[model samples]
Target: MIKACALLLLAFNCCAAEIEGLSAIGVGGIPMARQEAIQDALMQASLWNGAKVEASSSVENGRVSELQRVFPVQILDRYKLLREWREGSFYHVMIETDPKPDPVPAEKIAASAPAEVLATPVAAAAQGVLAKPVPVRECAQSDFAYRKKLLLAHFQLQNPADANDLSHFQDGLQQELSRMLSASDHYLPQRTVNEAAFNLQPGFYDPVLQPERVRELARRYGTQFVVGGVIRDIGAYGEQYGLAWGSDIRSGERKISASIPMLKLNGWMPAVAELGLKIKPSSRRFEADVYVFDGASGALLKQQRFADSATGDVIQGRDYIFGSRRFYETDFGKMVEQQLEQMVAGVDQALACQAFAARISRVDKDRIFIDAGSTARITKGDKLQLFRVSGSNQLVPAVNGDSSMSLGTPEALLSAVTITQVQPLFAIAILESGSIRPEVGDYVRFSMKESR
Candidate 1:
């Protein structure tokens, strides 16, 4: 990551007042790049001092010939080019400025009072007071994690033979888990039929996995994470017995009994007793290992095993009261729902531990546009922090699976902003403080909390 420093550079010899500035430039087309760097530097300096400066430039062959900036508040005491270098596509230069030896007269300060930016010519404004670019930095642990679009794939069954219908069990678990997750305040779950592989090489699991393929699926769904799981064990269990009822024909009385029938009891009776089937303490068990992966990097973020069981009673081969036995309404469904509840809570908590941010797409005067909108749980009147990019670099692999890493450190805070208008996929905001102007590709974020 690149680090840009902004501090008090130099003090005047004769005057008590001090002024300072630091600026860096990257490579583009030679003339254009230099021009941009110089302009940005001046604007950054102006932001620090909160004063507008005037510029005069001479052009040569449609390029910059000579450029001079005049600070109406004070004169420059001294200046120096601190450092210059080339990295990747950017040519960086850091410059520092000092204040003049003598203070300006009071009447001069009054005469050069700043005017409205719109009243100036476009050329002058462009070359005039640009707010200092805030430095971009690594997000702290307290950073916000936005609710993201997510996809839950069908869980693979560890013991397929244990499930009478593998597809049904997988679908059942997936749907229930999705329901629970969608109900939470942590994520916006997206339903998808995409199947992601579990293991790369042949292992105890089925369907060979390719990490790249999983990432592609996530991209297609515009989701930040993909959830998958394995059904480790599942089964339905119960015992059945017979109950008997007898009637005394003469007395018109009836007797009912249940017993472990043996050969020694009252021998037998015809048309006096009837036997019916009954189930005792029937139960269904569900156990699964759930895994969550980063959609951008295909790395596992969380994993856990969750299990639960539900029990019920049956009489005459039917529910004790409902008089029917259906898959969805039975103990199996109840047990599955319980398992999903646990899984959902686990996933919601895990994802909330991550930081979330939206990128700036455009900037017009005091208003800025962000890439996140209603889908991301952003609303009108929400306040967000703005960061300026100072420097960034790709992280090299120092250990296994670190090749995809990148780092950016923000140096200064621009200002807070509030959402003024919201669309389905984007939002527009205006700065609460105009001391710093936001730029495209800057980051905006807010702290996340559970609403429910």
Candidate 2:
């Protein structure tokens, strides 16, 4: 028995190699169970080697059932057949399988049937039908080395006072950039910290000095973009007055007298700037706006502003003065940090949008087809809704209802279509609804229900 099994295996391999486009056809008197088992085994084998199986169903009663199955196999210019016979069974079982050709050469699959036919064809007969396997390309790590370098530059943060403090910001930026790049599948070069230019001076609004300084720093650091902005105090004041008049009629002279002494006005100042303050208690606060720019071109890419009340005591003889203390300990510093975080988030969003646009352009669908044996991602026996835009002229009521209005109406309807074959670019489906027939270039959408 062992020797016979080995011989059978050898025979199977030889037969499989020699056969081209062998389709399994179950004749009369074959049990459904046996046929199904053979089909399943063939499908498994095809899928295991990246091949595809196309099967047709037997006709029942007087109606033709639109049922077909395709395996995960991909053929590349080769085909095979498998046949099994039971010594006692009356019918011989034959299976036909084909190797998918590369780049799936296109041929018209939906040819019209002959005028006279004994029964409806279960599947469309096309010349050289094949399924191509999805290709997986291995990308070399060196291809992304440039991206790693770019990412490194953006991840590093610099401040003048503490060279080592830049690392803290760098760590934060690295986490942010890492998450963004991972989600986007993008990479950039690693950025090294510029120890000489790590300065984040607050409340310093020297536009002339700052712009050149930032540009120079960016060039030295080998960065294409640099983001820098200033925080300032903007203040305003206003006043309102009320008038009172007193009239006196003395000695029937009808004399009226009005006197205006002084009217004091009061209003709230929106914001104030205070320097060097700890996080204490105060009613005054300020607003901070941070802007990011392209390092090379000095283009304003993004900006965000936040408002927070000062929380500390005021200095003597000064109006709304927040006393000098540790700058980092002050609420102003905290606000700056908050603004920085928001700026980073905005930059990340911009990067994501750029990546998404690039990815989407690669996969925009141009056309779709529905028929039995049409290649698609849909499974066998699944229903899809077919739709197309229809234009018609209709009479609608005018705005005043005095005159009739003729308008062109554009509408769409869903027709039930069942999937027969799912291929890479198109799906083969049968129209379930006799009333609606889908034409080429019509939209095709999937639906689970017969009517929707």
lDDT of 2 by residue, 3-35 (tens): 100000000121243221122322212332233
Per-model TM-score versus the true fold: 0.46, 0.22
**How does model 1 fare in lDDT?**
0.53
Candidate 1's C-alpha runs over 4 A off are 1-146, 165-167, 197-211, 237-283, 311-329, 358-371, 381-420, 428-452
lDDT tens readout by residue for model 1, 1-452 = 22222111121234333232223332113323333344344334433443334444455566664433334243231334455555555555554544423444443333343333223455224434433332222112222335666778767766666664333556656666666677775677766663743552336453354445556666566566788877777765664343533331111112344454452354774332344343343565678788887665555677788987766621112221211125445555555655677888788666765655566888988789987788787888776766664533322223555423222123455666778999988899887666676787676755322121
Number of clashes in every candidate structure? Answer: 13, 45
Q: What's model 1's lDDT at 417?
A: 70
Give the C-alpha lDDT of model 2.
0.33
| Residue range with the least summed lDDT across 10 consecutive positions in model 2 | 2-11
Candidate 1 lands at a TM-score of: 0.46
